[model samples]
Target: MRDGTDHGDQMSDVKKGLLPGQLIWLWLTGVVIALDQITKHMVVARFDLYERLEVMPFFNLTLAYNPGAAFSFLADAGGWQRWFFTAIALGASVVILIWLARLTAAEKLQGVALALILGGALGNFYDRLVLGHVVDFLDFYWGNSHFPAFNIADTAITIGAGLILLDMFLGAGNGAEKKEARKKHD
Candidate 1:
């Protein structure tokens, strides 16, 4: 019942594949990585290792390093945490890449989140491998309460994490995706 043109069209669609169209998300990842690295590089060039510049009443740009995990956890453990954190980030990067490969382009929520997390992971990984620590420059504080300094990579990672949570709770990314998944279960 199909003509030669119809068959050709079908073949073309099949040949287009799933991963090629997903390159946009990869480019988004590249942009995040570039911004994170550029901002950190500018901060390092302008500020001393521990110098702080008050950017506003509630914010400050400070040059600090975290040799450990978030909020300086285990930051004083000498040097072992460096390798430990590095390994974790690398493992996460691999997992995100695998997830992205499997995800469809229509899954924008998860796609964007995965891309952002990928960029953040690579940005921090670069810092860990080269500088032996992650850079921290964005500092926030209240009248007397202060928050730990974090970097652009940390910011992206946080946003990505939030998006992932939103997607999971809202059944977003693709409505039909959830429906099909539920149907498979039933």
Candidate 2:
């Protein structure tokens, strides 16, 4: 009934349809994609493919390109798989961005997770479609055991995946709506 209260409710209703934070999330996601691509470009230009530069006892920066999925799986499939992977990434990115656009700004962590995934997906998709492979550089190992060379994009995607999993397990009841519903019932 009050003026300020009505305005606040209107703002809340507007946010329920399309939150401002989602745009911020989109921008951040674009930044991540840019950073990932630029870093990969630098690595490709600076180092020869598969050239390892040991920076730490267990860490190495190198240039490696993978045509397939994680741990180089299906990398030797006669090169037709690059386009396949690119299509998959592009499709996934579309779905993620659409979902992000519909999500509320208050779902910060979930939005962040989705944005990271979107950026990472597009980053790798760019590489696969443009260069026919995904450029990787960060490497870690302990003697004979190696943990596979990966890049910033891959790391972001991995973290995003973890966050998605965490949200699935924790976000359900802990979400704002559920809390509000509980309060109303109480």
Candidate 3:
């Protein structure tokens, strides 16, 4: 019961496929990368390597470099960890970029979230590789206790992870195949 005209039209649509949401996601990834780099550059230029500028009752702009992973894991490992971490990050970024290019337009939020994480990961990855450490600023404290200092890239990764978790829970119904599965499960 298929017509030649319908088949040709369907093929043409596939060839020209792209939704607005996809464009937004791509743009979001770029924005996160640019913001992360710009802020890091500002922090590096304005602040001495490890100088602190007390800003408020419980916050400061302190320049510090992390030699290891979160909370400075293996930071005192005599510096071998830096190269290892950088290699891991570079590998992960490569995989993520490839994934982003292959994603369809309808999977906007998911793609965007992934892109943000990827960008942030690469941003830190670059620092860790080139500087042998990741920069830390934006210090917060509760009396003597302090939360770890972090940057915009870290924020983007955290937010992206949260959005991805939300998307999975809310059933975004991004693609025809996914929608069918969701409907079946529901």
In candidate 1, stretches whose alpha carbon ends up further than 4 angstroms from where it belongs are: 1-18, 172-186
Instruction: Note the Cα lDDT for every prediction shown.
Output: 0.83, 0.81, 0.75
lDDT of 1: 0.83
Per-residue CA lDDT of model 3 for 103-184, tens digit only, reads 5554566787887888788778878877889888979999999898888778888888897898787654545666664345
Ranking by TM-score: 1, 2, 3
Q: In candidate 1, how many Å is residue 95 off?
A: 0.4
Q: What are the TM-scores, per candidate, against the unseen true structure? A: 0.83, 0.82, 0.76
RMSD of 1: 8.4
> Clashing residue pairs, candidate 2?
none
Which residue pairs show collisions in model 1?
Answer: none
Q: lDDT per residue, candidate 2, 22-64, as tens digits?
A: 5787787888899999899888889987898889999999899
* Best model per TM-score: 1
